[model samples]
Each structure stands twice: as C-alpha cells, then as structure tokens.
Target chain A: MNPLPALAAAASEKATQSGPTLAVSDLRISAKRDRKSVELLRGVSFHVASGETLALVGESGCGKSITSLAVMGLLAPGLSMSGEVALTDAGGRIDLVALSAAERRKLCGRRLGMIFQEPMTSLNPMQRVGDQIAETLTTHGICSRQEAARRAVAMLDRMGIADPGRRALALPHELSGGMRQRVMIAMAMIGEPDLLIADEPTTALDVTVQAQILELIRDLSRERGMATLFISHDLAVVADIADRVAVMYAGEIVETGPIDQVLDAPLHPYTIGLIASRPALSTERRARLSAIFGAVPEPGRRPQGCAFHPRCSLAKPGLCDVGDVPLKRFDGRDVRCLRVGERVQA
Target chain B: MSIANVTSTSDRAPEKVPDARWLGLLKGLWRHRLGRAGCIVLAVLVLVAAGADWLAPHDPTEIYYDYILVAPDSRFWFGTDELGRDIFSRVLFGARVSLQVVAAAVALSLVIGAAVGLISGYAGAWIDNGLMRVMDGLMAFPALVLALAIVAVLGPDLLNAMIAIAVVNTPGFARLVRGETLVVRELDYVQAARAMGASPLRIVARHVWPSVSGNVLVYGSLKASAALITESALSFLGLGVQPPTPSWGYMLATGMQYTQAWWMSIFPGLAIFLTVLGLNLIGDAARDVIDPRTQR
Candidate 1:
C-alpha cells in the first residue's frame, strides 16, 4: 500500500482542527453532453492556510479558473462536481460540498469573497463604485446600508484611491483601469472574509498598475490574515504575490510547493517549461521566449500516463505514455512525473 | 496601505464637473433642430391643454346660434361647428380629454409591461418561456382589433377606451423590455452581483432595471404617440368619450357629415395632426438621443 494517502489523511485531520482556512480534497468535475461525458477536473486538491496565498498557475484552458470557481461554488450549470471541500469558518469545519445552493450562497461574499478577472466588466456601469463595494457588506447583513456605505469609502481610501468619498460617487466608467481594479479589490475585501479568491485580478491592467495591485493584494491579505486562492497564467505575477504555487496541467495539479522552490528548482517537466517560458530582461535581443511545445490537451483527449507527456521534453516514449502516473512526494514537494527519480539522481 | 499613498497619485484625471446621463440626453435633444421644434410644439400643446378652461374664448358647451357655421373669422379663430358652438373653444377642450387618456394609458402599459419583462427575462427557462409565450399570444392579434374587442366587452366609455389602448400596448413594451433584460442579464456586472451573493430580487431591481430603463424610456415615448392615435380612432368610431366632452375624434366624426361646412372638419383635423406630429418628433429625437450608437 502507498504511504502517501496515509500521510495525507493524517495531515488533513490536523488541518481540520485549526490550520488551513480552505481545504479541497479529491475534487472531480465532469460534464455530460448527450451520451458522451467529459472530465473537466480530475481529483484536484489544495489547501490555503490563514495569511498565506496559494497561486494556482496554468495556461488558459487548463482549469485553473475552474478550480477556483469550484471552491467558491460558482460552477456553471451542466457541470457536475463531487468530493470534499472543507471550509474552516469561525472555528468550525463545514463541508461545502454538502451545503445546498442557498446555504452555499449565504457563505459566499460573507465567509468567502471572489474578485473576477475583468475589472472593467466586473462592475455595474450604472452604479457608483462605492455602492458596488458597499453591496458586499449589506448583502451579508454585516451592517446597515448607511454604515456599509461609509465603510466602503474607508475601504476605497485604504485601496489608495485619492478623494475616496468623491471617487465613491463615480460610476465604473469614470474610474481608470487601475482604479477600477482597486475598487474591485476593495469590494472583495470589504466583507473581511476569511478566504479570498482572486481569479487573475491583474491580468487586464498595465504592468506598473499590475505591480501595485499585486502589492495591495499581498498587503491586505497579510493585514487581514485572509487566505487567498490566487489564480493566474503568469508565472512572474504568481512569484510576486503567492507564498506557494501549484502548477496545473489538463485539469490536474502536477506540482506544488513553496514559490521559490518551484521557480528555482522545478521537479515536474511542465513546471520547468513554464518557468523557462517567461520573458526575461537579460535574454539576448531577438531571442524567442521558450514555450511548452503544445497546448494543454482538451479534457477527453488527454494522454494516458500523464497529460503533459506529449509536450514534455524529458518524456520517455513507452513509460510516459503507458498508464496512469500518480503524484509522488519528492524533496518536500509533490510532483507527478515518471522520470522525477531519474532526474533527481542526475 | 498608508494614508500618504493616497495623495501620491491622486487627481490623475482632471477634476471637472460630473455629468449626468439624462443631462447629456437633454443637451443632445436641444442640439438637434427637429427635437427642439418638437419640444416647443409639445410644450405649447401641453400648456394649452392644461389651461383649456382659461384659454378658450367661449365655453365649449355654450351655443352661439347667431354665428352658426361661421368660417375662420375675427370672433372665432377656428370657426363655428354644426351645434353653433365655437369650434376654437371645443378644440381647446378636446386637448384636455386627448392628453388625459393618452398619458394614463401609456403610463399603465409602461409600468405593468416593464415589470413583467424584467421578471420574465431575469428568471430564464420555464418562467421565461411561459411569460414570453403569453406575451406572444397577446401580440399575435392586430393591436386595433384587440383594443376594439376590449372596448366592446368593457362597455364603451372614455375609461374603457383608455384601458383597451393600454392592454393593446402592453405586449409591445413587454417584448422590448424582455429582449433588453435577456441581454443585460448575461453581462459581467450582473454575474459579479451574483458572485457577491445578491438576492435575485435585489439583482433585478438594482442592476438589471437600471441598464434597461433607457431603452424603456425611449420605447415608452414612442408608444405614447401610438396610444394617442388609438384614443383618437376610438373616439372617432363613437366608442370613446360621450358627447359634451369635446374630444378631437368625436368632433371630427360630427364634422364629417357636413361637407359644405369646411371649417368644422379642418380645425379639429389640424389639432389631431399637430399633436400627433409633435409627439412623433419627440419620440424620434428621444430614440436618437438615448441610443449610444448614434452619438456624435
């Protein structure tokens, strides 16, 4: 019998007592179209401790966003999800998967808050930005509308918007892109949620604004002791704000560890490729950024042994394509690759 | 997170006066010549209608038998009718009846239809299908025929005529608002509202309603003119306001029988034409002003 399951079970038992703010285990999501079925997410699992940010990194269509949405109970209709999603709320561990739709909705924007990808579209154009932020607080009955409105302005000021009182009165279109993102952050953070899900919050902003938004997220998470599940395709951005990183491929997490360790000495070939693909300031002029050879395989078409095997440089033909390859513990991190033992020896 | 960070990059954009959307629409309407003309004509019509008691030279019901069928002359600017009553005074009183029916009918349809559309569109699947199918059924019949049937069943009177017009127009408003709601419901802000745990009712009221209101306002103005035409048609058919009320359509009906007395038909006919023209112009201008695609 593999000892990994036993070890993980023991750890999770302790996790339930008082550790991670959010813990998702063996989550599987599948979709049905007529007689055919497709697995969108396969046994995805991760945990985020209080005051720590766990970045789920992957290219587009690799289910990074899906994992976050699943955690938040915001998956689209026609998709089915199963397995345990344990959320630690006010010293109690509630299995979110067991909650009804209305019960789940009550927890959202109260115990948990999410910031979407598009800042421009995430806000109601007709409403004042301050009212939008205040809505989060009033929605959960945390405070009266009048009190919520005042706190919303204070939150906006904390987000670094100048003349926040007047700015609060400004509609979504009146604010700049960066300011809009700050407002989004303020909206998500206003409830003072225990778990914050930021799904590529800075992807639409300018580079300078991107850095500032990342800093704001980090500082706020630290200040509030909030556990953040940060989803991003950008490795550089993940390295900047995330304490830990999980690299996903074809709907499954392939490698996960401390951010520095994953970036500097990646174990999985996919992680290695991801870190290598980032454009660096030191690269020679005209040199093309290295990228993973092929796109992430569609759910139903993924290869047998490992989803990344077809694009992996270190993949051996017969072994890598033979059968299911399980995630194994390796050097204080988890990695899913057949040749990790050989790579480590070398 | 410091207070100093707030001032460091504040005021990047120039601090100009905040502009309201409706103010922009008003400015746009004023800039267009036809819109300005429509505004003036409608303003005068409303004033005349409101002050009909004071404005008319003679009492609408009072008879002046000595000057029967007189042409447009010094005493009667619009001439006298078959009853020997001043046509000018009758037409002024007719404005009051016409404006009252049109305003009440349009307001009823706008309120009821907009509410139905909003609820149906936001709550998709069976509710949407069921509500929309009912609206479609209502719209299937010709608007005039439907209004006539309603008036016939409800008993012919000014109130019954207004109700018939409102019922006929409800389908149009419902269909328009439903379409707008379907589009607005899928927008990201709405999804953001859902993510924030907003109740369905709150989302519909606060988010969905505001986005579709501009289109509703434009459509309502356009429908208001149609309601006026319907009200006039009902009165002309003798199924509307009873005699002594001085409705434009009733006056037109009475005047048509006396072909030799040209002043009788011409004055009432001119009132109907001018009011309809003013309303149509205002509707057209409102559509252009509210429609973002047409903005200069």
Candidate 2:
C-alpha cells in the first residue's frame, strides 16, 4: 500500500505491451531410428524482447545448439521437432513453426539471421566475400545486385575492415580467420533482421579476436535494436554480453534470470557451479576452478527427477530425484531446484 | 578492430596461397617441366588427329603390292602392312580414330557417372547403397574382360567397343566424385547455405556441384587415358575398328606376324605408347594443379 501500486503502474506504463519480439515455446526435438527414439531437446522455451540479448548457456550435449537449430528451422536430417516459435514485429506476429518450409525459408535471412560457431568454415570458400553478402541481399530482394554490392562494401567498412572495397573481392580462404568472421557477420547483419541467432560465434576464435567480434556484435545489435538468442558454453563470455541468461542442463533450461542477478547471486546449483568455474581475480592461484562434478547425461539416459540431480550437491535424495522438477519462479527469478530460498513444509 | 596479432601475415606467406595463381592456371602447370612436355604431346596429337587426311602421304588403305612388307625404305616409309597398305599413312590416320574413341568414352562417363555420383553421395543411405552396388558390380570384372564381354554381346565394331569401354570406366568416375561429395556435403559452408535460405536445388547447384566438379574433371582425364588403352586392346582382338580402317591396334595385330618387317609393328606401338603416356601426364599434372593438398 505504501508504494507497490505506484511501481506496478509505472512498470505497466514503461512497457505497454510486455510481449517479446521472438517467443519460442515448449520445443521438443528427437531423433528416431528403427522404432527407437532419442530425445535431444525437452520442452525448452524462452522469449527474446527487442533490444535484449538472451544467452542460452550450456555445456556440450545440453541441447543449446539443437535449440538454436530448431529455432532457425535448420535441424539436420533425421531429427524431428515439435514446438511453436512466434516472430513478432510492427506488422503483427507470425508463428514460425506453423509456416511451411518455403515460407520459413522466406523469413530466414530476412527477418531472422544467424551466424555459426565455426568462422573458419561458415562461408563458401569459392565465392568472393562481397558476392556472398550480396547473395543474401539479392535472395531477400533487399536491393538490386549493384546496390547490394555497394552495401556489402559499406558493411565491410563498418566492420572495421581496412580497404573494404578491395577486401570484398577476396575469397574466404584468402582472408584471415578474424577477417572471415567479420565477413560472416556482415553477411548475417546486412539483412538487419529483427532477431539474430549467434550460436557460439566466437568459440573457434582466439581470445583477442573473440573480444573484437563480441564488441562488433554488441554494437551492431544495439544500433539495430535487434533481439538476440546467443548460445554458448562459456559462462565468462556469456557474462560479458548477455543481458539475461538461461542456463540449460540435459535438454532443459534449469535456471533463468537477469545477467547481474544470475551472475552475482545464482539460484540453481548448476548456475552457481558455472559462475564458480570461471577464472577470476579472486580465484585462488593453485586451487582448481570449481566444476560441476560428472557429465550431462546422454539423451535417452537422462536421470529421472531433477536432470541435474546426479551431480547436484544440494540434491535431496527423496525429493530432487523423485520426479521431474519443472522450472518455477521464486524471488522473481526462474529455477528448477527443489530448494532455493524455500523452507521444507515437513 | 585491433585485429590483435593478425597483422604482419603478409610477409609470412599464408599456408594456403597457391603459387603463381592466375585464371589460366598456366603458371601452375608450367611449374613442372614434365607437365609442359605432356601438354605439348597432347597438342601434337590433336593436330595430327585433325589433319589426318592432309597429313597422310597416301590413302591409308591403299594396297601398295609393289612395296609389300618393305623394310623402312624412304620410298615406302614405315614399309607396308601385309596387305601392302601404307603403314605410315595408316599410323597417321589411326590417330584420328584413337582420339575419337577416347573422346566418346570420356563424354559418356562424364555425364552418367557424375550424375550418379551426385545423387548417391547427396541422397545417401539406401539410394547411395543401391547406386554404389551397381557400380561395384560393374567394377568386379577386370576392365578389359568386361569390355570384351560387352563387345561380344553388342557385336564387335568400333562404336560397340567404345560403348563397352565407357561402361567399364563409368564406375571409377562415380566413386571419385561420390567420395569427394561425401566430404563436401558435411562442410559447414553447406549448412551455411541452408541457413541462407537456399533451396535444396539451389544449394546443390550453387554449392555442392562446383566444389565436386574439379575433382570429377580430373578423374575424367585419367579415365580417358584408360579408355584409350582399352580401345586398343579391343581393336587388337578384332572387336574394334574392323580391318582396313588402319587402327594402331589392328596394324600391330597383323604387323606382329611379319618378323622381317620390323617397322610394321614398331611405328603403331610407338604411337599407342606415346598417346597413353601423354594422357597420363596431363591428368596427373591437372590433379597437382587443382588440389591444393598436392601442390608444392
């Protein structure tokens, strides 16, 4: 009664519509062979608002890449997906999952652009870098071929490439790995898509190039007010760029919160383990970086109850491992832990 | 934007830069003197094939009874075959038939084999197994034996022999491009194409085909050489270029019986040997030039 009502009203006024630019709901991906099916992603969901960067952070096999692929509708052959992905804009919203492959393709590289982890092999080696970027523009009917070329050169220049006009004529192989990655970014962002999905974009690069690439992505996203669904396994890198973070474990997002709160005060055991594992100034010199014990379970072999139970230090034998622990909110943050700022009723 | 230590690379010489790279690939080929020699041999063969009619000193089939089996006299150069046909003239004209047969075999294998390779490698699984099995079955028999059997069935003639040789060699090309495509299809660039919203057809045409074509063409050249040798074997067996056409193999077959007429067999055998050698050299050189892994 003191000030809560006024704060709530201000929140509503600040965001007249709290809806997201892209919403992915309850995505489940599996592969089937001979009557046996193995789940890759289990009911993963998240929303990305305009001008917000939401990072999906997980170790390998935690289904981060699969989720990104599912969102892009580029899941490899033999994998099947069931979900809903809505892309919203000023023109209104369209269900990405409901669209036919042809329609989804039309939206891809136009409304939704994506960059991959391997900058080394992400571009066609035979095509000139400028032509490759122009191809994306021409395919989307974004501009005339000549206009596309001019824009491609301009985009390269904006990426801080020296002699952008001459560099545009170079092949992917002729360029350094960092330069090639910049070319890839130009190709993806030239469309100025509403949503940009960068799946571990800097994983293949060295540390310095990594920072440069991250800065480029951050600047470009801010300039375009583009929403991003960034996927990575590196918690330190994620901390540097992501505004909000969703930590996944064994095909499910186990925790989610704003970056500051999540990094400063992690709720789920897994998130705590991730933040602890990052090498920091305060970390003891000889002490090993803390790591979550054991491994993410293979699909079809995920432990029952809390998928993270096998290695979770706070796991209550009878409760945490008894059944699937669905994500729920506590203290205005999402978590899947059995005990997180909660008292046992018994 | 600092690019960090990525600078100073220009003086270091990048690992992948092809030396003397130019659109014509002339510098690359000329780097190896043997390859240049091979190119010269092929050029000469083409000129001889094209001008066979004007180059022959006499009608190839002319039975010069007056100079029957003479031993390399300038008056009747390369002596004469058992039928008194001008051995020199027949050898000259034989170049035309050899080149035509090789050309036809190469064309057939190039189209049919490349298409099969693309489908098998790209489609994969059962389609891959099924198409590859048919190729395996064809490859099971020794090329010459299979070509001979096919000639026996189609009723021996130059065209039948060429068709048989084409059939025999198609499997090699299919396997070559299929292996190449399997590697290419999994490359990240391929997935990038899909992410670019390229349709399956566009991805295949624009991405898959170009990367695979270079190796396929290289393999095609080697297969052409094999076809030429196989055609010679067929003609030697009376299954190709029926007599009086003056094919090198046919000339050698009859020339072998006349021990006193040494020039009878020597000239035709030299022609066949040189043509096959020329082809092998060109193919090997092309492979070296196009595949960076093989470059020095």
* Maximum-lDDT candidate: 1
Q: Residues B62-92, candidate 1, lDDT per residue (tens digit)?
A: 9888988888899998889877899999999
Predictions in order: chain A TM-score: 0.94, 0.92
lDDT of candidate model 2 versus the reference: 0.83
Residue pairs in candidate 1 whose N, alpha carbon or C atoms collide under 3 angstroms: none
Per-model i-RMS in Å? Answer: 5.0, 3.4
Q: Each predicted complex: what DockQ? A: 0.37, 0.41
Q: What share of the true interface contacts does candidate 1 keep?
A: 0.43
| Candidate 1 Cα errors over 4 Å, as ranges | A1-14, A32-35, A299-305, A316-319, B1-19, B63-68
lDDT of each: 0.85, 0.83
- Supply the global lDDT for candidate 1: 0.85
**TM-score on alpha carbons, each prediction:** 0.90, 0.90
* Worst lDDT 10-window in candidate 2 chain B: B15-24
True contacts kept of each: 0.43, 0.40
